[model samples]
Target chain A: MTMPSVSDSGLATDAAEGSVVLERVTRAFQGRRVLNEISLHIAAGEFVALLGMSGSGKSTLLRALAGLDEEVEGEGLIRVPTARSVLFQDSRLLPWESVLDNITLGLDGPDPAQAGRQALASVGLAGRESAWPGQLSGGEQQRVALARSLVRRPQLLLADEPFGALDALTRLKMHALLRALVGRLRPTVILVTHDVDEALALASRVLVLGNGRIADDFRLDLDHPRHSDDPRLVGYRQRLLITLGVTESA
Target chain B: MSAEGSTLGGRITSSTPRTAQASSRPGGTRLVPRRLTPLGRLLGPLVLLALWELAAQTGLLSPKLLAAPSTALITGYDMLANGTLLPHWLASAWRAWWGLGIGVAAAVLLALASGLTRIGEASIDSLVQIKRAIPTLALIPLAILWLGIGETMKIALIAGSVFVPVYINTHAAIKGIDIRHVELARTLGLGKAVFIRRIVLPGALPGFFTGLRLSVTSCWASLVVLEQINTTQGIGYLMNRARDYGQTEIIVVGLVIYMVLGLASDAAVRAIERSTLRYRKVIGS
Candidate 1:
């Protein structure tokens, strides 16, 4: 693939545009193609949820969009905002550093401590500047991780099954926190998950990957504070579960 | 209300602030009182001393073989009053200080060299392994032949004793950091210098302290051996002199000093570990 636009610094040329465009992107490992000629465009401030089965290349596609995987042997033009951040399934916090330092790490600014404090406060972690990551609960650690990502004020946030490891209750709390933060920050977010209800509840647009390509794309016009039993979402959930090959009875 | 919506608001309002605030407020209250441990540590030594005094007074144990606690104490006090113990103690302390300092510096340098790069590991690791296989005491003959029974030989011996544990532990610590953190550093665009300073150095610290505790004990042991080599000063020299004069009381004093030094250094390292590793006080830890 010719990456004429992706610079050596990996900063997006059209960063202010805050868009992601992938054209005919394909990736293979040992002659087995994992991603096959996938093309998609995400506009600024759009919440996009990617859904697929375990090996359906959902994560591979998300990694590509995040500029973390670049060894694909296919013709494509992948463009993402230079100001971008990724939140993985694990909260990947530095165990030794305090929560505030972890958020402000490698930060370039006039007053990073102040910014870190503000970010922590936004995540409801105020007065936890001196607390270590290990001291916090799993949900709290993920909140600090969220604060770390949001401290950069990225235009694009790519989250890969961030709440997959969390318990059901913690996942609900995280979903609410994520929704509130995304509403406030309005970054173009692409969340990768297999949870059909999560995608239906959180995303404005949900894309389903099947056989290494985009098989279904749905636009949901549901209002904020969405309910799991909204009755309107049952069809989308059933269709997504069917797309994921999960039979209702089996 | 659905199960999800009912729990969502209740969970958010009830769980978020209470636990976060509760966990953050335990720093002062959680520290066990410092006064408790001194009494605990003293109990063993005090009971032993009492047993020794009773045995000496009752004549159950011969004083020739083992000096009484009172005799050892009087001899120690007389040596202190006559100004004999101070010079010997100073000389031994100076040698230990120089030897341990040099050894730690060299070990840290070697560890960084070997731990950071494949080339460094290839060059230094095999030679260090060979050195580690041989005991430091086995090198005493060669050490004397090379540098004679001088301060240089003694100091070098102590340095050699301290080198292995510090280097091995520090290197392992550097290599043992989780790769996920390295990815985090790269994703954050941390520069090479910053990565070494922030991640590599702090990550290696716990192991470094472990190695330091080991090396401190070994450093004292090496001194005990090296100071017996035609030494006119030091605690080892004092003990050697006392052995000839059949001054078992003085010999016991020397032994007590060594014990004190070892205990003190270990306690110092433990204090540092406690303060630095306070982050490890997670639930059930």
Candidate 2:
């Protein structure tokens, strides 16, 4: 089935850049199909959250979009901007490099150091430029990872459970930080997560992946700074949880 | 009734205090200090030396077999004053430095080749493993046949022994680098040179230093064995000559020199390792 075009979706204007389109993307491992004939489209400046159970292929779809699935057997067309960055669950910072260096790593053009400093400042890590990755706490490391991702001014930002390893309080703080950053950067973001509350908290559109296909796709029309206890969010959360085959106890 | 109540209250309060003190004392004692001051570190060695001196003075220890610490020290000083120690020490140091340098260079090149490429691993790794199984001393016979008993053979033996630890550790470290970082590099569009410079080299450093410590010790060890092979001007040669004259003090001096050299080189490597790997969060900072 064909998906709606960006114009009809009314999510973004610059459909030419920072947009992702996939058609009949099929990924398999050991004769088992993880993603089968899955088609998806994301517009520029859209915050899309992909939710799935274990082995539901949410990460696979994200990897394919990021062009990191070359070693995996897949047959499909994936169109993504060349200027894209991926944030994994772990910070993935080079431990030997300082925070500023990690941010500016592979950055081009004149005075990349200034840009790196600004990026660090933006993530509330202004004076931590010389700090090693091992010296920073987990939450701090994730913030540095966020800065590194946004430093390049990537057109598409693909995150695979970036805050999964953080504590609950840290996760809440990161959720807010990510929201503010994504708001300002306006990059098309695809956040693959298992937490329904996180998806509802950050994403404008949420998609549930199950049985190697998109099982549910819907939009949350809530305003910014969404509360988990909001009745509308509660309704969406319950439906999403049920779609994920998880029943909430009364 | 008032006396009975007062005695009961005093007994209860006394038991509570004792229990609190017991609990607090264990907590205080549980925190054993792990760090030692420099003087504290020297205490054991100093005590051992004192005991050795006492044994020698009491005549319980034979000077014929092992000279007293004082005698060894005087002998060492005499050798230093008469200029007999400098040339021999220099010769051994020179041999060790050349051998270590060559071995480290070769190990780095070989590790990069084997660790970075499939074909290099297929061709080089197995050969290194095979060489590792055969001790470098075992090849001294063959080396003597090939290069003859000279500086060349001595250095060759040292280099051959030093190469194994460095190559094995470096190659393993390169292979053990987090694959996620490699993926990050690709996503960041890093070229081959940049990836090697930023990721591969730094990632391999800790392992390389570990191997280097082993290599340094091996350099001294093989030198001792190599110097005995018809050498005229190394510590080993001096010790061999002393063996003929039965001058045990000079032999003790030779042993002391080797011990100091080995310790100093290892300490040097450790300093460099600490500076380079300061990023790591290890015990005792």
Candidate 3:
């Protein structure tokens, strides 16, 4: 194994207005506490991935950011009173609508028609505006979902294992697309996933959630659009695997 | 990812291409897929007609009781050409159309109000359920007593026929939309105007069209029952008069025309729905 470059710790602090601040955010369902006083801060315009086992509170935390679950509390002073969008685990495309309309679902302006077109083009779905949701494959539907969150051009982007359903290769492509999009749009993104390699290849900081709290937080200090084969990524991958107690590179 | 083949990290998946292909055969032209659906739909009606004609010609059915398809078709045109059938059809069309328009408008207002408020929904659900279960046919005596045996009575009859289907369908569509989409609109900071105009209406449209389609068909068919009791000039009146005179050919003609008109109206509405939805979702800007 080879050591890789770690650039200066010049975080994109100014790009995002309000960094995510989670302070003792506790969530309970019925009587069972799903998340117990989980507190963390994700910097502005920085890519962060929350890695955890299924049923862990990783998705719950992400949903809280999206304000989907307002029941969770004690999340302190969020900066940049800015817009946010959430990408779901399932693509959740309206079954009857076309891919184009799905992307433009929440967008509003005097000219949504133009915005929808431009967003479709950005996601490389330029010619598929009229294609029905059922007509698109799983990967394409996921891409449309990505386009959906992107169409908002949100300051805070929350994703709940958005690529968990895609094939590995498609996931990789989506990761790259997401990386490029974040690089260009500079939206502060918090991605929740069970895939360690994905965390290494994409996020600048990786946090693991265990027993309803942050078990580990490791800053990669990697560049935007980092390669999957980056030597630093290889080391990080191994470390994540040992932490998760698995050797498979999946 | 290029649009050609490879996408998402070299994963190749087929993009649905709405294309036309050509086949090689005698006088083979470019094999633009014919819209066979429209033609295929005609088979059921045609087969029924064939069977009916066969039954009538074989004397298995009495001419006084059942007219052959051929004679019925000819006599239908004969009546229409001479304007003997026009007044009846026109009258039925007027009552059905107006009653349906009023029913739909009122139902839409009610559904919207009920769906938007918990109190309204609770208050109306029981009432609507009770009203829905009460057979509209049983209301005829009351209708005559209140509105008399006039146009108002007939219109009431028509309204009673079509209201439940439209109202139920509209309400169901409103309830069926995913809650997530509703939140999406809210976070976007759109005012109530844009939200209802764009999100709520389109989301409810498929079901709304579904209700409208069924009710319209019912409107056309149920008018005959309405016409039989009171007013004159409608397919029902024509059918009744033909029965009285033993004019089975005229009765059959009226029946066939009514069926054809109902079918044509349904097809027209369906086309409108498809075209509107397609235009709304038109891809590639």
Candidate 4:
């Protein structure tokens, strides 16, 4: 298989610090290849959105980057930061634990509680420390999940459809919150999502997976606060949608 | 019928105003009545007792067959006054406590073994299932042969019966813990001890409580049977002696004590369950 190398256009100075480099990474399940000898590179502090159909290996790729697929049968090298966190579709908070406890779970430091409180405040949820996870709204639970991820001060943030379960309005609010948090934290993020607009809205670079490989990789240089109505974004959206096998008549 | 339908429709359309008026009223009444109050629960038993007393007084109920409630109460009072009931009650209670304690401890240990490890499950689960098919009461003859009809034999039988439910439920609960949570623990880099304490233990608690409730009832049940065998100390012995002398009132007293103890212990376990699992969105709470 001829390996195609996907690289960032610029920002290579701090490449060794928080950058991701995959060299012909391949993953298989039950003798069926999911990620087939794919090579890619992501620069430090880049927000990369991964778009794919249901079985297009977006989550498989993300899981590989998160070191979650160690037991998975794969042949290749995935270089991601040791300090990384994953945000799942569901909040995945332990219901038995309080909000602060969920955030501070497995966190070791002089005062993890203080860091947890700060993380909670950053997610706009202060003073909800003692509340149970079940008591929180769906959006609030996701926010707590975001807090838990950020509390680790990860260099890489891997999110698999974090806003997938939220209501449309809540999803919009979360997009804004995530954008702001990412702006401040500056982690190299790889978000796996099915929503094209979500990818364009938050990510600096978007990659579409098809046929167990990177079918299309687009560097979205479009500025932040990029609206679906924006002509440039509309252009990108149309192209990305067509690539994703969607054809809109209008 | 059309006119009545129109009237009902009118009422339905005016429901908003009616609801507003209801809300505006001081100390608004509940739309749904509470399931049961303390007094309400006692009413059925009280009425039954009243009927029984009336029947006995009217000579409809034969006193030789079964004692009247008043006769049984007087008999119980006399036993308490003469200190006979206390010793017997203490002996029964002691046996029950020991059996339950030993059984529960063994159940927890076995459940942990089977639930946490594949090897333990492979080794222990099949044996327990086999034992479950054999009734503890049926083992009395064998137990007497082994332990010689002493307090040890009685307690061993009670413990043997009590262990099954607790083990089954706790093991099931441990196995039933969400796989996602275990994966979450792995991602969080939680150590084995931390994982067990935070995830496994709390996850199994509801199951353990369920098992405990069954075990509490089983303790009293087995104790009742165990006391009847070659024993002169427990409530079963008292009942057995009363049966020989044809003291129907004393027998009734023994039955009443067992009933109260069973109810009390179940209530205690439920109270503990309620407090510990208050986070659950329980229906009818």
What does DockQ give for each predicted structure?
A: 0.36, 0.70, 0.08, 0.47
Off by over 4 Å in 4: A1-16, A69-73, B1-38, B42-44
Error of 2 at A144 (Å): 0.7
* Cα lDDT of model 4 by residue, A129-205, tens digit: 99999899999999999999999988889899999999999999999999999999999999999999899999999
Stretches of candidate 3 exceeding 4 Å from the true structure: A1-16, A71-80, A93-119, A126-137, A224-232, A245-250, B1-60, B186-191, B279-285
Q: Docking category for candidate 1?
A: acceptable
Question: lDDT (0-100) at residue A124 of candidate 4?
Answer: 98
**TM-score winner between candidates 1 and 4:** 4
Tens-digit lDDT track of model 1 for B1-285: 698898898878886775655555566455665555657978988999999999988999787778898999999999999999999999999888888999999999999989988999999988888999999989999998999989998899889889899999998999998787887787777898888888998899989998999988768777667788887899988888888888889889999998889989999988888798787763432
Clashing residue pairs, candidate 2? none
- Per residue, candidate 2 scores C-alpha lDDT tens digits across B102-217 of 99999999999999999999999999999999989999889999999888988888888899999999999999988899999988999999999999999999999989999997
The estimated TM-scores of all candidates read 0.84, 0.90, 0.80, 0.88
**Per-residue lDDT over A102-158 for candidate 1, one digit per residue giving the tens place of the 0 to 100 score:** 999899999999999999999998999999999899999999999999999988998
Q: Pick the candidate with the highest DockQ.
A: 2
- Candidate 1 regions exceeding 4 Å error are A1-16, A23-33, A64-77, B1-60, B282-285
Query: Which one is best on TM-score?
Result: 2
After TM-score superposition, what is the CA distance of residue B10 in candidate 3 from its true location, in Å? 56
Residue-wise lDDT of candidate 3 within B76-143, one digit each (tens)? 78888998888887888888888888888877877776776798799876787788998887888898
